[model samples]
Target: MNSAEVLSSDLDLVRRSLLVQKSEILNKHMEFKNLQHSSAKATDEADAVVQDLQDNLNIQLHERDQFSLLLIDKALSKFADGTYGLCECCADVIDVRRLKARPLATLCIACMEDQEAPGKHLFQ
Candidate 1:
């Protein structure tokens, strides 16, 4: 097919993947919520401590999942706006490998590295 068809197909694939991931993350967050509530019934001192640690871990995991879900949502919006495969910072096409690795990515490797670079002065 043509380039437009190929891009449409790729965006469809990305959309499907992100929807599946979003569902899975929501399910896990629900499970974590249930676990957190159930842990309040821990009786033994050791059990309570263990439960606390588990709760903390669950909270951290849920927060990361939430952030991922938000990114996926933003990516979906980009797709709607016909800018799915383009880098947000430089407006160039993002690498396919990077998109495959992180479908929700909005930046290309160079832009991402620049954003992540440490010790850069604000003025320069």
Candidate 2:
């Protein structure tokens, strides 16, 4: 497909991803707050563990929301400049499969592979 078509699709996906992230962040914030409030009332180790899990989830959700915001901003800027498919790392056309999977991606598969290789534990 053409660059214009790819950019259009990427923008649409970025918009959807931002919306979903907003909702998820809000929900996670609420859950974390509730857990914090009730944690003092926790009577057993199980409740403490659950509260700890909720705290961890809140941190993860916040990080993901931040990442989503950054990706959205980058994608919008790229769309405006008509260079969305050009890899930020190498200025080459990103593979279609990679772009389809990560619509807001600013780097090509090769660059992404290098970035990911050094951070395998960060993924999950």
lDDT of each: 0.83, 0.73
What lDDT tens digits, residue by residue, belong to model 2 across residues 65-101?
Answer: 7677677677767767778778988999877567667
Q: Which residue pairs show backbone clashes in model 1?
A: none
Provide the lDDT at 33 for model 1.
77
Candidate 1: tens digits of C-alpha lDDT, residues 39-77: 678999999898888878887887898899899888878
Candidate number achieving the greatest TM-score relative to the actual structure = 1
Which residue pairs in candidate 2 have backbone atoms (N, alpha carbon, C) closer than 3 angstroms, thus clashing?
A: none
TM-score of 2: 0.53
Residue 77 of model 1 has an lDDT of 83
